[model samples]
Structure formats: structure tokens, C-alpha cells
Target: MIGVLIFPDFQILDASGPISVFEIAGRYAKSPASIRLIAAEPGPVRSSSGVEMLARKFGSPSAITTLVIAGGDGVEAAARNPCTLSFVRAVAKRGTRVASVCSGTFILAEAGLLDGRRATTHWVRTRQFLATYPAVKLEPDQIFVRDGSIWSSAGITAGIDLALAMVAEDHGEEIVQKTARQLVLYHRRSGGQSQFSSLLELKAPTGRFGPLLTWAREHLGTRLTVADLADRAGMSARHFTRAFVAETGTTPSKAIERLRIEVARSRVQSSSEAIERVAEATGFRDPERMRRAFIRAFGQPPQSLRRSARAG
Candidate 1:
């Protein structure tokens, strides 16, 4: 049985999205799966969005094969509750697959399930999560992460991705593909995809440098330099570099590479363009240089990503 643990003011989608995927997968599976909404204090638990879910009191941990904790404004409280933490710890010790959605990771971390484990959470909480759980290896860029039997995901929608991945694991790629099609999702996104799109990352600041970023994105085919960007921003090279880093939390060169990767990746996945052509168009004039950049950014080459995208 899959037990989704919830508390007051939990994110509604975090629980329902996964539940829907599992429910659909159960229908097509050889053996149907059972699911339940569980909570420390059973009753009508209100979600952050004002939707309420009827939850039963968590009873026997042994009956649960999978335990997913949902996250929201009440996570801090859930993490502090002895009943919730102890339940999670006991279930994990019994070898149940433990998982979390969004800030639900905080609860698992508090229960010591995430200690020395590679995990991820919503990108918005990356800084706070890192500061709080320095022992956990956090991959902030991933849409989801699986380490052993533990799984974690980014935000509400990513929970659906996580559940789809679990379905793929339990059933098969074909089952997940069908499930994705049924849900109208274009494809099941690989966990390696960045949490932020290139445009979203560049949309950080609307300050003086914002226009410069826009110009750089448009001129990706050209050799953009610090001096060029500084000239556009009407600042000296040295001053612009420091100010750009301060505003965007990344160096100008790194930002440019990220922009190129984003555009290149989109073209590679969505178009039938050759790798060399895509690389040149994205400002990585050399195909080999683009391959190295793809490796650094995604832990795989452009060809691998394209293959996966097509296969999905």
C-alpha cells in the first residue's frame, strides 16, 4: 500500500498528483496497488490552497510499502512533531520506500532519513535547505532524485514527475509512457533536466543588466565578452563583472554558457538539427566545446539527451 502522509496546510497537488499517477498505474498493473491518506492526527486536513483531504490515523507502519510525505506551510510543524518523525523513522527502518514532495524533505531530514543521502527539494528553498542540512548532499538542479529506496522531488508539479518515475521503476517504461500520454504530459521529463529554464534563470533581474542579458540572448551566435556587456551596461569591465555577479549570483561567462546550453538543448530536443549546427547556433562554435559544456551542465553529452528525449 502507498501511504501519503499529510499535515495541516499541506500542498494539495503534492499529494493528489502522485496519488493520481499511482492510481492510474494500478489499473494497468498485473497486481493493483492500494493507497491511503494518512496523518498523525486523523481528520479533515486543510491544504495550503484551502482544499481539504480526509485522512486516516496512521496505524501500522508494516502495512505500508511506500510512504510519501507532502509538504507546505505546516512542514515546520510536521518536522517537529514526535509522532510524525517517529513514524517516518520506523517505516524507513522496516525497509519501506520513503519519499517526499517539495518541503516534505524537511520532515524526512528531521527524521534522519536523509542523512548522508543525496536528495533534492524545491529550488526556491535551496539556500535554506543547504544551511539547515549541511550533511545531506543536495542536488538543487534536479527535478527529482532517487538514492537507494528514498526519493525526493522539487515542487508540486515535480511530484507528478516523481510519481511517474516511480511508476516507470515499478512497472516499465511502456507503462509510464502510456500514463504520461493519458495525463497529456508531452513526455516524462528526465530527472537530469534543470529546475529552471534558461529564460527563467535569465529573468532574475530587471535592473540595468536585464537589457544586457536580453541582448546577449539575442546575439548568442556572436562572441559576447565582458567588455561588450560592460559597454552595453555603460560600466567598466571590472565594475560590470563585480556588479553582475552581485546581482545575478553568477559570473558573466558562466551565465553566458548557461544561456547557450539552454538554447542549444531546446534546439537539440525539439528540432532535427545536427549537433554541430546546434552548437554553432548557440555560440559554442566548436562541437567538441559544446559537448564538454553539455557534460558539465547535465552530466551527459548532447547526443545522450537527444536520444533520451526522443525515446521518451
Candidate 2:
């Protein structure tokens, strides 16, 4: 059985996403998985979104094979609750595969389950999490991380990714693929994938030059020089450069490079395309230049990422 542990004002999707994954996966598995909502107080638990879910009071975890704790604005209070902490500790001690979603990691850390173990939480919580739990080896950039029996993921949607990965582990890749398709997810993101995307890192991705960036992404094979982008945005090259830097926190050339690298990395990981061909299609033009860019962005070359994806 898979148990989702929740508290008052928990993030709705943090619980729902994983529930949906396991529920859908069960349909494709020979032995379907059972899901239960467990909480400190049985009855209706209101989520941050004002929605409520019925939960059973905490009891013997002997039947639970996995426990997924949720995270939200109320996580601080939840972490402080003695009963909540004790329940979490008890669950972990039982040898269940314990996991956390987003700020739910705080609960596990507070219970000392994360000491000296690698984990990750939402990027927004990196500084606070580090300051609060100095003993944890936090990898803030990861979408999800597994250190032995304890697993953790970045933010809301990342919980779904983590759940999908767990489904893959429990029921095989085929079941996970079908579950993902049923959920209409484009693809299951690998744990090692970055929590941040190039477009998201930009300060004002949907602002002023958003359309221009969209155009650039679609036509990455063409030269995306500052002058070219300036012409497309109908501004002087110097003015465009200054405005782009001011708005996005990066120069036009750098932004374009980041965009190219993002697209190239996705293609490299998701496709069997030749590295040289990927480089040429993504505007790197030269394979070595693309390789260097991949190293700078992901700390690994394109080939390594491809190999890791295949292995996964």
C-alpha cells in the first residue's frame, strides 16, 4: 500500500499528484497498489486551496509499503507538531520507503531522517532549508533525489515526477509510461533533471520580448545574433541589448546560448539523434561548441546526458 501523509493546509497537488500516479499505475500493473490518506487527526483535512480530503487517523504503518508526506504553507506548523514528528519518525523506523514533496522535506529533516543524507526541496526554500538543517547535503537544482529509503522532490509538480519514478521502480517502466500517458504528461522527468528551465530563469519570460524569445526558440537553427534579434524586435542593436539585459538578467548573446543549450539538451536526452546533428539544428553549428556549452550548463557533456537517459 502507498500512504500519502497530509496535514492541515497542505498543498493539494502535492498529495493529489502522487495519488493520481499510483492510482493510474495500478491499472497497468498485474498487482495493483492501494492508496490511503493518513493524517494526525482523522476526518476532513482542508488544503491550502480550500479543498478538503478525508483522511484516516494515523495507525499502524505495517500495511504501508511507502509513505509520501506533503508540503505547503502550513509545513512550519506541521513540523513543529510533536505528534506529526513522532508519527513521521515511527513510519520511517518501520522501514517503509519514506518520501517528501517540496517543503515536506522539512518534516523529515526535523525528525533527523535527512542528516548526512543527500536531498532536495523547492529552489525557493534552498537558503532557508540550508540555514535550518546544516547537516543535510542539499542538492537544490535536482527535480528529485533519493538517498537510500528517503526520497524528496523539488516543488509541487515535481512530486508527480517523483511519484512517476517510484511507479517505475515498483511496477516497471512500461507501467510508468502508460500511467504518464493516462495522466497526459508529456514525459516523465528524470530525477537528475534541473528544477529550473532556461525560460523560467529569465526574470520576465512572458514580458516585453517574450514573443521574440518564442520566435528565437522556434528558429534556433538560424543565426540569432543581437543584431538579428534587434531587427526582429524592431529596435537598435545597442538599445535591444541593454533592454534585454535589464529585463532578463542576461545579455542577448548569453540568453540565446542558454536557450540553445536548453533545446539541445532536451533533444539529446529524449531522442536518438546524432550529437552533431543536434548541435547543427540547435544553432551551435559546431559539435565541440555545443559540447562545451553542455558542460558549462549541466556539468556534463551531451553524450553523458544521452547515456544517462538511456540507462534510466
Candidate 3:
């Protein structure tokens, strides 16, 4: 059985998305899955969007093979509840596959399940989560993370991805594909896929350097050295470097690399372009240099990502 745990004011999609995936997965898997909505205080739990879902009181979880926790405005309170924490710890101790959607990772962290484990939550909660749980190995860039039996996803829609991954593990890729198609999802994003876009990483997209960054993305084929960017921005190299870092929270070089990698990855996955051509087009110039950057960022080279994208 798969149990979806919810609390008052939870994000509706965080629960419903995974629920729908598992529901459709059962139809394709060899063994049909049994799912139940569980809560600390059973009844109609109000969601953040004012929708409600009926949930049963948490009881014996021995029959549950997987437990998915939902996250939303009520997460902090739920994390503080002794009953909720104890129930979570108990379920985990039984070796159940425990997962969290979005901010629901807080509940797992609060229950001490994420200590020293790589995890991720909604990108919006990165700083707060880091401050609260310094012991956690937070991978803020990942769409999802799996450490041992515990798993965590970024935000809202990512819950579906996590659930589909779990379904793929339990059943097979064929079933997961069917489930994704049934849900009308375009494709399942790999866990290594970045949660943040190159543009979104900037503090202010429409700020002083916005146009410069936009122009840089469009002209990735050219050398984007700090001196060049500074001249374009009408600032000295030293001043541009300082102000760019302050506004974007990253060095100009790193930002440029991110943009290049973003474009290179899109082209690598969506088209049949050669790695060398992609590297040159995205300003890496050397295929070897681009491969190193891809390994550092995505944990895989261009060929691997292309193969995975095509296979999926």
C-alpha cells in the first residue's frame, strides 16, 4: 500500500499529483497498488487553495510500502506536532519508502530522517531550510534527490516526477511512460535536472544588467569575457565584476557558463547536434571544456544526457 500523508492547508497538487500517478501506475503494473490518504487528525483537511481531501487517521503502517508526505502553509505546525513526528519516525523505522513533496521535506528533516542525507525541497525555501537544518546535505539545484530509502522533490509538480520515478523502480520504465502519458505530462524530468533556470538565478531579471545578460544569451557564440561584458555595460572590468556578483549572487564567469551550459543542454537533448558543434555554438569553444562543465553541473556528459533524453 502507498500512503499519502497530509495536513491542514497542504498544497493540493503535492498530494494529488503523486496520488494520480500511483493510481494510473496501478493500472499498468503487474500488481495493482493500494493507496490511502492519511493524516494526524483525520477528516476533511483544508488545502491552501481552499480545496479539501478526506483523510483517515494514521494507524498501523505495516502494510504501507511507500509513504508520501505533502507540504504547504501548515508544514511548520505539522513538523512541530509530536504525534506527527513520532508517526513519521515510526513509519520510517519499519523500512517503508518515505518521500516528501516540496516543503514536506521539512517534516522528514524534523523527524531526523534527513540528517547527513542529501535532500532537496522547493527552491524558494532554500535559505530557510539551510538555516533550520544545517546538518542536512541540501542539493538545492536538483529536481529530486534519493538517499537510501528517503526521497525528496523540489516543489509542487516535482512530486509527480518523484512518484513516477518510484513507480519506475517498482514496476518498470514502460509503466512509468504510460503513467506520464495518462497524466498528460510531457516527460519525466531527471532528478539531476536543475530546479533553477539560468535567468531565474539572477536576483533581478529586469534590473540594470538584465539587458546585458539577455544579449549575452543571444550571442553565446562570442567570447563573453568580463572585460567584454564590462565594456558593453559601460562599466570598468573591476566595477562590473563586483556589481554583477552583488546583483546575481554569482560571478560573471559562472553566470556566463551557466547560460552556455543551459543552451548547450537544450540543444544536446532536443536535437541531433554534435557535441563539438554544441560546445562551439554555446561559447565553450572546446568540446573537452564543455564536457567537464557538464560533468560538474549535471553529473553526466553530453552524450549521456542525450541518450537519456532520447530513451525517455
What ranges in model 3 sit over 4 Å off? 190-256, 262-283, 287-312
TM-score of 1: 0.73
In angstroms, the error of model 3 at 312 is 26
Root-mean-square deviation of Cα positions for candidate 3 versus the true structure, in angstroms: 7.1
Candidate 2 C-alpha lDDT tens digits along 1-312: 788999999999999999988888888886777899999999999999999999998878687789999999999999998988998888899878999999999999999999999998886676588778879987766778999999999888889999998988987878889889999984455323332533455334587879888888889999989999999999999889756644543457767887888789889999999999999999999999999888767777999999999999
lDDT of 2: 0.85
- Candidate 2 vs candidate 3, lDDT winner: 3
Ranking by TM-score: 1, 3, 2
* lDDT, candidate 3, 1-312, per-residue tens: 789999999999999999999988998885677899999999999999999999999989687889999999999999999999998999899988999999999999999999999998886777588778878988776778999999999888899999999988988889999989988884465324342533455334566689998888899999899999999999999889766644543457877888888889999999998999999999999999999888877778999999999999
Question: Could you tell me the lDDT of residue 57 within candidate 2?
Answer: 87
Q: Which candidate is the best by lDDT?
A: 3
Assess each prediction's global lDDT (C-alpha) against the native. Answer: 0.84, 0.85, 0.86
lDDT of 1 by residue, 1-312 (tens): 899999999999999999999988888775677999999999999999998999999989999999999999999999999999999999999888999999999998999989899998876666578668878877766778899999998877888998999999899988888888888873456333342533246645366577788889899999998898888889999888756644543457877888898889999998789999998899999999999888877778999999999999
Worst 10 residues of 1 by lDDT: 190-199
lDDT value, residue 300 of candidate 2? 78
Q: How many clashes show up in model 3?
A: 0
